[model samples]
Target chain A: MRRILRKHAIVEDDWTLDDAARTPAGLIVPLARWRAERELLLASAAAIGVLLPNTEDVEAIYPQIADRPLIALQFPTFTDGRALTQAVLLRNRLGFAGELRALGDVVRDLVFWLGRCGFDAIVPRPDQDLEACRGALDELSVAYQPAADAHAAVWARRRMRASA
Target chain B: MYRYDEIDRELLKQRTAQFRDQTRRFLAGELSEEDFRQLRLRNGLYQQRHAPMLRISVPYGLLNSAQLRRMAHVVRKYDKGYGHFTTRQNIQLNWPQLAEVPDLLAELAEVQLHGIQACGNDTRNITCDYLAGVAGDELVDPRPYCELLRQFIALHPEFYWLPRKFKFGFTGATIDRAATRTNDAAVHVLRRDGAVGYRFFVGGGLGRLPLLGQEMNAFVPEADLLLYACAILRTFNRFGRRDNIHKARIKIVLREWGVERFRAAIEEEYAKIGASAEGGQLKLLPEDIGRMRGHFDAPPYRPAGEAAADLRAQAASDPRFAAWLKRNVRPHKSAGYRVVFVSLKAPEQAPGDCTAGQFEALAELCDAYSFGELRSTYDQNLVLADVAERDLYALWGRLDAVKLATPNIGLTTDIIACPGLDFCGLANAGTIGVTHDIYRRFDSLEAQYEVGPIRITMSGCMNGCGHHSVGHIGILGVDKHGEEWYQVTLGGSAGNDAAIGERVGRALSRSEIAGGVERLIRAYLELRSDEEETFIECYRRVGMEPFKARLYEAEGESGKPVPSESEERPPGESGQGARAGMARRGVAAA
Candidate 1:
C-alpha cells in the first residue's frame, strides 16, 4: 500500500489504480475507461472512482459525481496547473462530497495549494517526504481570496475585526 | 498607501520565514536548481548575468516616503548603492547576493513591503496609472480596485502556476496613461448606467508576438470584478497552451481560438463559478471597497491664492525654468497643486538608474513637496504628484541640483532602454551603449524640443521589455553573426490608440544605428506638416514610404526595397523573451 498525506496526516492509500482488463471494484479507472464502461462499472459490488486527465472538461465529471467515491486529478507536472482548477470546480462547483485525491507530480511545494483547492488526499511522488508534505499544509494561515478551504479571506477577517 | 494590519504583517512574516527556509534548502543541495529557480522567482529573486537581482514590488506605482527610504536602505546595504526603475513601475536591485535576499526582504517587511508575486509565472504586481487620483482627466479612482485585485491575485491557489507569466494593468482616466492595453489583462474604470464599473480587455501581450488586447466585456459590475477575473484566469489556466513555450501566453490561446470561442469558453466558466456557493464569498462588498478607498483619500491641501500667477511670472523670467515647467510639469486635478515629474533620464546617467543618495534625496523631497508620497511612472521616471504650484520654482531648483530635472519628459532624449547586454544574460546586443551614443547625438534640449513629443523605445532583445513595439520610433537590437544590429519600427502608440509598430527597413550596424535614428528624426523634421505634427502623427498621415526613402537614401544605397527579416529568416528567430519571462517576470531586463 502507498502511504499518502490525507487531512494533514500520513495514512495508507487503499484505492487501486487503472487495471482496465480486470474487475472495476476498488479501482480508480481513467476517465475514458470509466465513461466507456459506465454501466458495467455502476453495476459492480464495490464503489468506484475515476481518474481525470487535466485536459478533460471538469464539468463532464459533474454528472457522475454522486457515483464515485474518489476523483484523482492529474497534475502531469508540478508546473501544469490545469488540475488545480479542476479540483476547485469539483469541490466548489459540483460540491463533490467524497475524497479528492491529487496524483502525479505531487510535491511539498504544491501540497499547500492542493489542500486549498479542496484536495483532501495528496499522493506524493515516490521520493517526497511525507512528513514535510504534511507540514506544508500549514505554511500560511492567511489567504487573500476565498478558496475551497474553510478559512475566511483576509477581507472577511478585517470585517469581523471591525464589527467586533 | 494601505496600512498593514496584524493579519497582513503576519502573512508577510510567515512568507519570509518560508522563503528563508527555501533558500537554506537550496543551498544545502536538497532542492534542485530548476525547482529552486521557480521558488526564488516567486519571491522576486533572479539569477542574472553577474548576480542575483531582486525586484521589489511597487504596487500600482505608489510608494510612501518611509517605504522609499526603506528601499534606499535596502539597496545601500545589500546592493552596490544603486537601483533601476523598470518600465513596469518596479525597482530592481542588481547586485544582491542570493543568500542575503531573505534579510533584505525582512528589512523591506518592516515598511510593510514584500516582493511576493512580483516576478513569477503567477500574477505579478498589479499596476495602475501613476497619476491615478490626481490626473486632470479623472474617472473613478482605480487604486482601491487595484488593491482589491492585488490581494485576490496574491498567492492565489488555482492560478498560481499558469502556462506563462500573467500581467494586469488598471487605469481610472480616459487618457490611458498606464499602458493598460499592453498587458495580458486590462481593467479600465468607467461610469456605466450611473454606476462605476470596469471594462475588461484580455489576451494582450508584447513578447515575440505582439497583439493588442481585445475587449472581452463592455461592462463588468464592480461587485463581480473578482468573480469575473477568476473565471477568465481559470479558463486560461485550464486550456492555455503548454506544449510550445513560445506559444504559451494567453494571446496565443486567443489567436488559436478566436475571440468568439474564447468569450464563449469564458462565459461558460464564469457561469459555473458565479453559481458556486464559494463564489458568493468572493464577491467584493461595497464596504470592503470603501475601506480600501479610504486609504487613498486625497491629502488635505492649503489654499493657493496667487501661486499659479506667481509661477507663471517666474517662468517668464527664467528660460530654463520655463522649459522645465513646460515639459516636466502637468496640471493636477486639485486646485492648488501641480503634477511634477522627476526625470531619471539625465544625460550623464543611464536611463532609469538611480543611486542610493538620489533615492534618499527623493524620499526627503517627497516628504517636503508632495505630502510624503511619490510614484514611479511606467516611462522610467518618478512623480511628485501633488506639488503646490507656488513651490514649483523651489522644487525645480532642488530637483535640478540632484540632476533629476532634465526637462525632457516625452522628448527623444527621454529614451527607455532596458539593462540590456550589460546585465541581462539573455540580451544579444548592448542597449545602454547605443542609447548614450544617441543621447550625445541629440544633446541639446532645444533640438529635442524642436522635434517634440516623440518616444524612442529600445530593447536589447525581442522580448519587448522596453516596449519597443509601442514606441513612436522603436529600435530592437538583433544579433547578426555575433555582431549587434538594430531594427527600427515606425508609428506605434500605447495610449487609447494602441497599435504595434511596423518594421521600416534593413537592420543597421552598431556604428550606424545612431546616425540612422538621426536620419529618421531629420526626415520627420523636414516632412512634417507643421510643428504641431508629432512624429507619430506625421508618420500616420504620410505613411512609411517617405521615412523609408529618407532612412536608407542617406546610406548611399539604391532605393530598391530591402528584404524583410521575416522573408529571409523565421519570425522572432530568438524568442529570448520567453526564457527571460521564465527567469524574470514580464519586465525581464530592467
Candidate 2:
C-alpha cells in the first residue's frame, strides 16, 4: 500500500492503478483501457479513475470529467513538466473538480508547484519524506502569478487593497 | 527602476530560504545530483569549471547606486574580486563557493536583487533596450512593461520547468538596440491606431541553429499582453520537444510546426486562457499598469542648453575629449542632456569584466551624475542615461581616471569576446589571448579609427552567448584534435535588419586568427567606396570573394596553410557545434 500527500496530508491511497485487479472497483485504468472499455466500466464502477498520460490532450476528457472520480496525470520524470500544463488545463480549463493527482518522479521539492498546478494528490517518490513534503507546500505564501491555486496573484490583491 | 514592495521582498525572502534548504539537502546527500541541479539552476547557480557561478538578475538592466554598491561589496567579499556582465544584461560572479551562495543571495536581496529565474528553464531575466525610457526616438517607455513581465514570470508555478531555457528582450525605441530578434521572444512597444500595444516576435534564438523570431502577433492590446504571453508559454510547455535537448528550444518547435500552425495553437490557447476564470484574473488592469509606470517615472531633468558654448570650448581645447564626445555619447531625449556609454572593452582586461574597485567608484559616480541610476547594455557596457551636458566634462574626468572611458564604442577596438576556454566550462578555444593579439595589432586609437564602425563578436564555443552570428565580423572557436582554431563570418547584423553572418572560409589556426582578422579589415579599408561607407556596407557590396581572397592569398604569402574546400569544417564540427559532443568536450576541457 502506498501513502500519498492528499490536500497537504499524508494518507493511505485507496485507489489502485493495477489493470488486472480481481475486481474493477476502485481501479484507475490507463487512458486507452478506459476509452476501450468505457461503456462496460461506467455501469458497475465503484469509483472509476483514469490514469492520464501527460502526453494525452486533456480536451479528450472534458466531457468525461463529471463521471471520473480521479484523474492521475503522469510526470514520467520530475524535469519533464508537460504534466504541469496538463494539470492546469484539467483544473482551470476543463473545470475538472475531481481529484487531480500527480504520479511518477514526484519529490518533496516539487510539492509546492504540483499543488499550485491543482494537484490535490501527489504520489511522492519513495525516498521523499512525507513530512518534508507537507512542509514544502507552504514554503512560499506569496505568488507573483495567478495559477489554479486558491490564492490571488499579488498584483490583484494589491489592487483590491488599494481600492478598499 | 521598479522598487520592490513588501510583497516582492517577501517573495524573494521565501525564495531564498527555499534555495537554502535545497542546498542543505544536496550537501547532506538527501537530494540526488540530477535532482539538485534542477532546483539550483532556477536560483541561478551553475557548476562551472573552476567554481560555482551565480548570475544575478538585474531586471531590464536597471540598477541604482545603492544596488551597485552592494554588488561591489558582494563581489569583493565573495570568492572573486570582479564580475562579468553577460550579453543578456545579467552579472555573473564566476568563483562563488557553492555552500556560501545562499548567503550571497541573501546579501543581494537586501538591495532588492535576487537570482530568481536568472539562468533557468523558466523565463530568464528579461533584457530591454538600455536606452528604454531615454532614447530620443522612443514611442512608449518599455521599462514598466518589462517590470510587469518580470514579476509575472518569476517563480510561476506552471512554467517552473520547460523543455529548455527561454529568453525575452524588449525595446521601446525605433531601433532594436536590445537584439530582440535574437532572443526567444521580443516585445516591442508601439502605438497603433490611438492606443499602445505590443508586437511580439516568437521562436528567435542563437544556438545550434540560429534563427530570427517571426512576428507571432501584430497587435496585442496593452491589457492582454500578459495573457497572450501565458498562452505562448503554455503552448510551448505542452508541445516543446523533450527527447532532444538540441531540438527543445521554441525556435525548433516553431520550425517543426511551422509558424502558421504555431500561431494557430497560440491563438487557441490564448482564447482559452482569457476565458478561464483563473487566467482572466491575471489580466493587466489599468491601475496595475499605472502602478508600474509610477516607479519608472523619468528623473527630474534640468535644461542646460547654454552649456553648448562651454562644451565647444572644451572640445576645441582637447582633441581627445572631442573624439570621446563623438564616439561615446548619444543625444538624449531631454534637451541639454546626453547618454554616456562607459566602455568595459579595455584592451588589457577581459571584454566585460569590472573589478570590485571599479564597481565602487562607478557607484559613487552614479550618485554624482546620472540621477543615481545606471544601466547595463546588451553590449556589455554601462550607461549613464541622463547626464546633463554641463556635467559631461566632470563625468568624463572621473570615468577616465578609473580607466572606464574608452572611446571606441562600436569601433574596431570595441570587440565583444566571451570568456571562452579561460572561464566558461563550455568553450572549445581561448578568446582573450587572440583578442589581446588583435588589440596589439590595432594598438593606437588612430589605427582603430581607420577601420570605422564594425562589430567583431567572438565566442569561445558555439553556444553563441557572444552573439557571434549577428556581428559584422563573427569569430567562432572550434576544437581540432586538442588544438584551437577560429572560424570567421562576415556581414552579420543584429539591429532591425538582423541577419546571420555567412562563413568566410576555412578555420584559421590560433596563430593565424589575429593576422587573418587584420587582413580582412585591410581588405575592407582598401575596397570601401569611401571612408563614409562602413565595414558592413562595404562587405555587403563587395561580397566575400575579395575578402576571402585577401585572407587566403595573404596566408599563402606567409607560408601558412591556404584556405581550400578540402579543409572544410568536420562533419559534426560546424560552427553550430553539435550538442552531442558537448558532454565529452566539457569533461576533456576540464
Candidate 3:
C-alpha cells in the first residue's frame, strides 16, 4: 500500500501494475507487456506508463515512450546506478518529457541524485521516510555538471558573474 | 592553487550539510550499514582495522602552510597524533571517530579543503606532477586545469557512485612524473601550433588487473576537455560490470570490449553529449578559463644570485650535505630557487607517516623557506617548492634536527609500503615490518647511492594500495595457509617507460623475504653494465633469465628456476612504449 511521490507531493496511484488486468483508465505495464501490447495500450488507455528493468534495452522502447505519461525505471539494487544513465539518455537522447519515476530499491538516500538524473517522483519502498526524502533536493546548493534538473553549473554561474 | 568562487564555496557548504545529515541518519539507525557505507566512503571515510580512516583531498598535491597547520590542529584534537600521506597526494588521518567526522569535514572546508570524492568508487583525487609549476623541464603548468577539474568532479551528481575507484593524473611535463599511465583517465597536455590541447587515455588502473590506459583521443581541444572526460565516465557508468566488485573497474570494461570498441563507444557517447544541451553546459567558458589561468601568476623570483662554486665547495667539504644535495635537491624553473625535498622515510619509521610534531615542523619550514606552501610527491615525500639556493644550508640544520633529512628520495631505503595488516582490514600480511627490514638492510647511504635509481615498492595484498604491481622491485604479500608470505616482482615501472613487473619466482616466507630481495639486488650489482645503468636498465637488458638464474642458483625446485609470470610476453616484446592498442600515435612516450 506504498503510495508514490510526484512533483514533490504524495499521489494516489490507480494504474494497473500487471498484464493480467487490462485497465482502460491507466495502464502502467512492465517492459514485456508493453512490448507485446503496444497497439492495444495506445488505443485504449487514457495514460500509459512503462516499467523498465535495470537490464532492459531502453532503446527498443524509446520511440513508444515519447507520448507516454510516465516511465518507471526499476533499480535491482540501490547502488547499481544503471538506471541513472537510462533516465539521462531518456531525457537527453529520447526527449521523454514525461514523469520519470524510480520504482524499486528507491530509498531516501538516493532521492537527490535520482532527481538530478530526471526522476521527478520516487516511488519509495514501504519503510522509507516520505518526508525525509524531500530534504534530499536541498542537500546540495549547486551542481557541477548538467543533469536533468538543468540547473546552471556552478562554473557557468561564476563565469557570468565574472563577465558582468 | 585555484581559489574557490562563491558558488564553489556554497556547493561545498551544502555538501557538508548533506553529509552531516547522512551521518545523523546512519547513527540513528535510519540508514542501513550497507547503504551508509557508500555515502561515507564518497566523503573519504574508511572503517579500517583500528578505527575510521578519513582521507582529505590535496588537489594535485598543492597545499599552503595554513592548511598544514589546520591539519595539525585536527590531528592534535582528534584520536591520533599522526597522519599518513598517501601515494595519490591525499592526507589520511587514521583514527578519526565516526561521529566527529562531520565536524572535521566542516573545519576542513573552512580552509578550502574537504574529503569529497577523496575515496570510494569515484574520482579519488586529480593528482599531477608535484613540480608542475616549478620543474624547469615542464612545458606547461598543469595545476590550473587540475584545480578546475578537481572542483568540477567533486561530488559530481552522475559520478557519485562509480563502478570502481577512478583516478586522474595530469602532466604537462615531458617526464610523466605523475604516473599518467597508471590512472583511470589521464590527460597529457601539449601545445601544438600555438594552441593548447590534451591527449586522453582511458581504462588504466593498478589494483588486481594492472593496465596501461590506451589512448582514447589523440587531441581534445581545451573547450571540449571536460565533455570528453564526462563521456568516458558516463559510458563506464552504463556498461561497467556491477556483478563482481573486483572486475568492476573501467579497465575491465576496456579489456572486455577491447581497446578499439571501447574507444568507439566513448566517442559515440561524447557525440551524444555534444549534441545535447547538457554537453553544452559542460563547456569551459572563456571567461572561466581566463579567471582560472590568472590564479597561477608565478611568484616574483629573484635573479640567479648564488654562486655554484660556494655550494660545490660546501658539498666537497661535507659528504653528508653532498648526499643530501644529490638525492633531495631538484632544479627549479626559477634559477635561484631549489625545490628541496623532505623525505618521510627515516631508518625504522613507516614511509609517509607524519606525526603532529613533524607536520608542525614542516609547516614552519614551509612558511620560512617555501613561500608558505608545500607540495606532496607521489613517492611519499614533501617538497618545499620555492626554497632559495642560499637557504639550503640553514634548512638542512632544521631538517636534521627533526630527522627529515633522510637523503633518500628514490633510493632502496625509501620504500613505498601501504598500511597493510597493521591498520588495513583488507590486508593479509604486514607491510611496515617488511619495509623496516629492507630499510635496515640497505641503510648505508654510500651503497644506496651507488645502486642508483632502484624503486622498490611493497603492498599488503593484491589490492595494490602500495602500488607494488608497478614498482621496479614490487613485493606483494600474500597469505598462505594462515601464514604471511611475500612475492617478489622485478622491473615494474610507471613513467615514460611504464610496464607491469613480472613475478620472479615462488613466494617467500616472512623470514626469508628481505634476503630474497637482497639476492636480486646482489645479482643486479654483479650483472650491471656500468654505474650509470640503473637496476631497471640492467634488469631490462638481461631480461629475467640472469636474475632467475641467480635467485634459483640455490633454493628453487631441484635447484632449477621456476617459470616466470612474463614468459609469454617478455619485456621488449610487449611493453616498450605500447599500451592497449594505441601504438605510437601523434604523441609518443619520452
Best by DockQ: 2
Error of 3 at B122 (Å): 1.8
- The fraction of correct interface contacts reproduced by each prediction comes to 0.83, 0.84, 0.65
Preferred candidate (DockQ higher): 1 or 2? 2
- Candidate 3 lDDT over residue span B1-590, tens digit each: 66776777887898898899899989999889988998898898988766898988898998888888888889988857888988898899888889999999999898888898887888778989988888877877788788778767777767776677889999998898888889999999878787778889998988778889899998888777788888888888888888888899999999999999999999988887788877888888667777887887777666777512266877898888888988999888777778899999998898998888888888899898888888898878888988888888888889988999999998999898887766666776778888998888899987898788888998877788788988999998776544566788898998889999998877776777887788888899999998888999999999998887776555743443334433222111222212311221222222
- Model 3 spans with C-alpha error above 4 angstroms: A22-24, A57-60, B306-309, B553-590
Instruction: Give per-residue CA lDDT, model 2, range B1-590, as digits (tens).
Output: 78888898998999999999999989999988999998988999987756788989989898899988998899998857999998988899988988899999999989998888877688899999999888888999999999888878888889999989999899988999999999999999999988989999999998668899999998999998789889888888999999987789999989999999999999888888788785578788899999989999998887466534367889899888888898899998888889999999887888889998889988999899899999998989999998888889888988999889889898877888887766666776777788888888886889888888889998887788888888898998877655577889898899998989998878888788899999999999899999999999998899999999987765554465444543334322333332323432352432
Clash pairs, candidate 2, are none
Cand. 3 TM to true fold: 0.93
Query: What is the C-alpha DockQ of each candidate?
Result: 0.81, 0.84, 0.65
Compose the digit string of candidate 2's lDDT tens values, residues A38-156: 88877754578988878878886667655688988888788888999998888888888999988888988889999899999988988889999999889899898888898787789
- The C-alpha RMSD of each candidate to the native structure, in angstroms, is 3.7, 3.2, 7.4
The C-alpha stretches of model 1 lying farther than 4 A from their native spots are: A20-25, A39-46, B306-309, B556-590
Candidate 1: tens digits of C-alpha lDDT, residues A1-164: 77998898798877778765655347888888887888987787657888988997877757865568898899888889899988988887777888899999887888889989999999998888899999999998877788889877777877887899
What DockQ would you assign to candidate 1?
0.81
**lDDT value, residue B511 of candidate 2:** 82
Docking quality category of candidate 1 according to DockQ thresholds: high
Off by over 4 Å in 2: A43-45, B305-309, B556-590
DockQ value for model 3: 0.65
lDDT, residue A44, candidate 1: 76
